[model samples]
Target: MSEYIKVAVDAMGGDYAPQEPVKGVVEALREKPELYVYLVGQEDVLKKELDKYTYPEERLEVVHASEIIETGEPPVHAIQKKKDSSLVKALRMVRSKEASAFVSCGSTGAVLVGGQVLVGKSKGVERAPLAPLIPTATGVSLLIDCGANVDARSSHLVQFARMGSIYMEYVMGVKNPKVGLVNIGAEEEKGNALVKETYPLLKECKDINFIGNVEARDIPKGVCDVVVCEAFVGNVILKLYEGVGATLISKVKAGMMSTLRSKIGALLVKPALKETLKSFDASEYGGAPLLGLKGLVVKAHGSSKANEIKNSLIQCITFSKEDICGKIQENMKQDNKGDN
Candidate 1:
């Protein structure tokens, strides 16, 4: 709402924090002079890092704190006891209208729990999802309820579909994106009670382009623009997607190195292979955004480096500039009216 976009970076949240993420923030500012940021973490440590670079005095701030929350700490306990910790202090700024967005690489569980409790939720929303994206052949796809609500319901899937569709269209520039419910089979009647109930609702929905079921195999095939599933299933799929991509790529390289003839061919084809495989590299796409929160919240990968952190910061820049939260609120209001 203010003239300048503001973001709170969790300087100590990720696996390589106060250094790697901090470095990323500095790089992001270099590219976008319009954006402002508040680096939240231990006073002495944060300042020491900031001293390594020179940024605009008014455009950046360092919010000093004394405590650091480990990703392993339980969310409820960490948030309560470590009130002065970087994560809590950062979220409080958003709650108090001091910052427009919050970014953390700390704990996924802590963000989901603390975001809902402190940042609050949009009206009429029952649950919020950690919505990250996966690169598809067409471009990218938004996968909702990724790890937030693993045990979701029929109605919850409906909301995920609705939200995912809106996100792809508004943020990712996909028009009339198709929504698919993850299932074991394409048959209308082939699913658990919740999936069975959700199928009909998606089929009847007029607000989105509701395609039918998408098996896990069809995901990388780019079958749908948006893949919808409960968090448990979605989380498993995400982990496997990353793991398999890494393993397969590693195997291909190892195979090429086994013989001299193959090594020559690998050199001949190395450039094309790298370009082709770049799409599957997760860091290129940046961190996942936790949707349905009142403010923008992004979860950079736990081991994010400077580039990843910078990309995540750039994501927040575009998100606020596009008014993603407001657009989502508008779309949800329309969905609610139709339900009524």
Candidate 2:
């Protein structure tokens, strides 16, 4: 028997709802035999989808949740009012220790609100930031505060750097990951008030491997392993990254089929090109994790498909095995003690 890693999934969340999420859970369970998924959603719909899959019945279970939190609803209001929502119930499972992690491809606002309100934060953690791993030329880099905490404070960025470092070192197996404050230029005195103020803090802090300012252009080159910034900047970087990647991929495909000669060339290079492009796909990296939380909560894209969901679920296994939350708490405790 394989070691069990219970992960609660929001089967009713995301653009495709029960179909994609349910398919994802089955694919994840099929790939990872040790994973036992709690598919939280309306049982009838989820059952219909799950019926299509051939897997060990004991590994996949559906926990009924009646309410569905819409994408447009206020996050706070949705999280509060919809106690029986698929999002809320899945989060509750994490809070209650029934599951090791919660994965949702739901409303970003609800996921952020629910992660903090439901899962709670680790002690000594003032604010938790959403950190997502982005593909880079060297490998992958963690972008902190990607879509969470838009008006984050300098202290928050510092914590993001520290938490990001811990995560990269332990979970991602990057030794002493270099931390960089996203800036307009490579200079120390550049950027807005937030970056200027956060720069020195990251520089002076002994917790992380601060590598000074990292311009946006250098991010894709993997100039730093952890890119720290407020959500406004981080979100822009994330969106732009996605937009550029998508456009490039689309253009490449279009160009490949433009002419008979190119089409023949495309056939010759298709396999190699496909493998190279697959590495850059954001879905392959899993979801954005809201760090500093008591229980692991990963928020996937609203339009996440089975591949992204499967990767997210699989990543949770590594997170649990590495005791990421425990390491964050321990590091935060040490930082707090030093401050006192």
Candidate 3:
């Protein structure tokens, strides 16, 4: 392929716009000499931002795009209409095999829609899932279908489990990662029709380590490496996880500053507490990937800053190096052979 793991970044995407995305690219270039980033956006704006940072000029190139895809626009229409937009231009690079992956903090809907239309799906993948790693008590777990495929089928959930397993195993360095279907109870018949059907399918698959049902309550306790569900359920769990983590962190800080005794205590434990809390930060894990596509397409937070963007770009290195898309396709081929 390319000499470097070229990442076509949507410089105009995200709440922070050209500034944060530009800074993140410069920051990423400083960290990795192997990474070649094509910052796709308005040339003049990107150039101005680049001037503020000192990084290797050769590694960071800019592709001029005339337009920007606003978050509020309808995804399908935007992708079709905004051909010269930053988001579409960056995706086209991936489609053309000029870039290894595409990273965007822009419209999630646009990314999801364009990724499938532009990058296309693997041979046997029916539906792509948005898989994001969420922090847990012990570590982090992959929450598949977080925002894509809300009405996913049993077979789709089964594939999600398998993809999630591969991602956890190879990229995250977890071996035979445990896969759990999100359910109300541990019983086989606890969930709706889809989960019940998928439960048996997952159990029959010898490829993944199928770890029965995982209750929502136990999710934060590091219940499993991969949690599988329809997009609706998965999204709820993810939102709740984010909300609770944020609330708890706020409450903890407020409590520490409430009174003289706690204030004194906060100072003594500040270093250790900060270290612990930082581990749970979602940004530390990078962006959520839309798996099952032919090429890697990651969707960073809409409000992403430099660190998040940098991490998202950095995350693609592992995906490309490990050949995650290839592995998923191979696994599906092997599974299909067994079925036949």
Candidate 4:
């Protein structure tokens, strides 16, 4: 048998819990022969869910986790207390190098806290960032610091740009990905103090292709491959992006079904429209990755279904194969040496 990429999955972390997670794991194992999974969750629940699918038994194993961390609980307290929870166990697997990555649809706070505290950060990494790929008109653009480090400094934004660049270029197959600082205007003097400070630093960086300020409106037009911002601004952009996309899709469907003539037109356009809509679905791109960590940690949507979970697991394969953490570590080391 070929070498396998083992992934530790938090089977009880999402809204669908063991059912969707189990189904997704089984689907991934069936689809990728060289994959191994440690499905961490309540054993009985996982086993019952596993009974519904047919997958290679050798490739999938059940690891027991007795507790669960709820979304409402404080992250630091939960991570310290829920040592036997599925999320924590999966993180431990990555930390110990037993698994190439950890995937969760659990509490965002707990995932972020546990990832940094347990899995630790790569050497010379200042702050870990949650970066997710957002759908754009031309393709997907990577949004870095989407939910981590809300009070990030200028240096952190620079690192986010560089790391986002590496991810887009290597993992997403975009060559010489253009990096842009999120701002209100096209001119360099337009954004707030943070952007003002970070802009010149990004321009000075020789490693990444730094583009000028990118307005929020221009993001959907694929003006840049990597979008860099502090978490506060990035989160607002992401949520607004999602809300607008959903509203537009809903309005389009409603308009199509409003009248008899439109219904006929909808029938003719449904296939192509569905394909286009599917490409824009955030779930199609998997989960946000907490980059600059010692091990890979993917935070899937809490409402993730079988398809999103499967994509999340599959994305880990590319991340591990490309040795993203190693590359990030080397890059950070180089940056630290330059500073010294």
Candidate 5:
């Protein structure tokens, strides 16, 4: 018998809703026959979407949910009001240990709230932070605290670094991933109170690689494999990195079409550029994992399509198969022991 990983997916979450997320779950089953998914959402709509895809009947199951959480509402309020919602139902599965992991492309606040309130946090986890991945010239780097907990403390940044290092070393296959604290300058004296304080603390910590500060300009250059910061700085770096990348690509395409000569030049460079830029497509990477929670809760991009959802579901398989949770527990143990 093939081993199966039970993953509960919130079908009604995200801007794409039923069609895209459903399509993603189906695609994952197709790729990995051993993945058993229990989709939580309105039965009628989820079934309607599933009828379109040709998947193994035994592999897919539906766990009915009647409500959906919106992006605007307070997370705690939404969780309380919408008990029957897909997001809540999925978290319940994690709490009950019915599913190995949970994946959601829903409200960022709601996911964070659900993670802490329902799924709970690890033994020493101060707060559960959203860690989305970004591809660098060296490879992919884990950008910790991308979404939740905006007002974070220096100790939180240190924990993010510790947890991030463990994740990159095990899941990402990065050898000695250099950890860098996001800052205004590489100098130790530069930055606001948070970065300035974090710099020395990180430097003193012997557990992480602790390569000092990484400026915003060096992000695309892939100077560091692990970028650690509080949610405020981390979120800004993520959004700005994406914005600059998108704007540059848009300008390039426009410039290429502006003249006949440029248009002819485009054909020769299109393939190379596509290959080079392929890693930059954030959608291809799927969702960000909300680490430090007892159970894994992923927040897929709001603009996630079927393929992105598919990747997120695929990620769950790896999440369980590789025993990421157990490894994290061990890392936390070592982190608490000492700097090294």
Candidate 6:
């Protein structure tokens, strides 16, 4: 293990790439003294962006890559053909143990593909789930399989629940985290074949604290710590969560400014409102981790800014320090042994 938690960041991946990604790296390096970063992108463009900030030069290195993978390109083909692309290069760094983790605001499809193909999965990990922490009324909950494994089986969902439990307990500091199967009702038999099949398996699973069903509407109220589902439903929940949160914030701002009286009230509540809104911002929680991978791979929003990038990088530190991959591997080993 290196003294620093080294991360290979895709500097040219996001919409604000080179600029936001570079700025975010600088911010993370400054904030985390024990962080080392390799910014992978076109050398000249990354250098130009780096010139704008004064960061710890010793901790930051620029690794040049020649190709760029556009969002429209097919993910598997892009990763296969664009050998020198920033995203692929960073993933290879993680595969080679040159970095402890890989962080990118790049194409999600490309990241997901490169992660499984390059970094690979831990032993006994059926599938890697994209788990992101989402804000709830009480605090935050982990949504597993948010964008990976859409046609996942019941067994895949069971693994997602277990992996999500480990993440929330170790990374998020939630003890004995409650696991909930995402469903349409609280009844055990009230879901599609997948949910119904997985529920019994989770309930019988002794390692995690399975808490039964978690309705979509009940998710925001923090009904469970780990919300488990296949990618399709989980993705819909995530997208709707973001959309509703943003719309509510916008509506509040508009209403506040609509009348002179409301404007005066808004002035008095702006500070509190701002803090409340910030807590609910998805970016504030960092990028989603593709859990169950041999090495860590975090995917930030495509339109992520410097702040989101910074938070994502910081999260990698905790993830590496906790040896999340090792822990997940050990858990899977235990599960396999139990079956035999």
Candidate 5: TM-score?
A: 0.94
Better of 3 and 4 by lDDT: 3
The 10 consecutive residues of candidate 5 with the worst lDDT sum are 331-340
**Across residues 1-340, which tens digit of lDDT does each residue of candidate 4 receive?**
5579999999988788878888888988988887899999999988988888778999998999999988878999999999999999999999999998999998999999999999999988899999989999998999999875588999999889888988897889899999999999999989899999989888888888998899989999999999999999989988998899899999999999999999999999999989989988888899999999998999999998989989988889888888899999888877834331
Per-residue lDDT value at 299 in model 5: 88
lDDT of each: 0.83, 0.91, 0.91, 0.90, 0.86, 0.92
Task: Report the lDDT tens digits of candidate 3 across residue range 1-340.
Answer: 2558899999999899989989888999999888999999999999998999899998988999999999989999999998999999999999898998999999999999999999999999989999999999999999999875588888898889999999999999999999999999999988888888888888888888999999999988998999999999989988888898899989999999999999999999999999998888888888999999889999999988899999998889889999999999998777645442
**Candidate 3 wrongly placed segments (more than 4 Å):** 336-340
lDDT, residue 62, model 2: 91
Query: Which residue runs of candidate 2 sit more than 4 Å off their true CA positions?
Result: 1-3, 336-340
Q: Which residue pairs in candidate 3 collide?
A: none
Candidate 4 Cα misplacement greater than 4 A, ranges: 336-340
> Once model 4 is optimally superposed onto the true structure by TM-score, how far is the C-alpha of residue 6 displaced, in angstroms?
1.4
Which RMSD does model 5 reach against the true structure?
Answer: 1.9
How does model 5 fare in lDDT? 0.86
lDDT of 2 by residue, 1-340 (tens): 4479999999998998888888888888888878999999999988988888887888888999999999999999999999999999999999999998999999999999999999999999989899999999888999998765679889889999999998899889999899999989999999999889988877778777899999888999999999998998889999999999999889989999999999999999999988998888788898989999998999999989988999999889989888999999998887734331
Q: What is the TM-score of each candidate against the true structure?
A: 0.95, 0.94, 0.96, 0.96, 0.94, 0.96
Clashing residue pairs in candidate 1 are 150-232
- Name the runs in model 6 displaced over 4 angstroms: 336-340
Per-prediction CA RMSD (Å): 1.8, 1.9, 1.6, 1.6, 1.9, 1.5
Output the better candidate (3/5) by lDDT: 3
Off by over 4 Å in 1: none
What C-alpha root-mean-square deviation, in Å, does candidate 3 show against the real structure?
A: 1.6
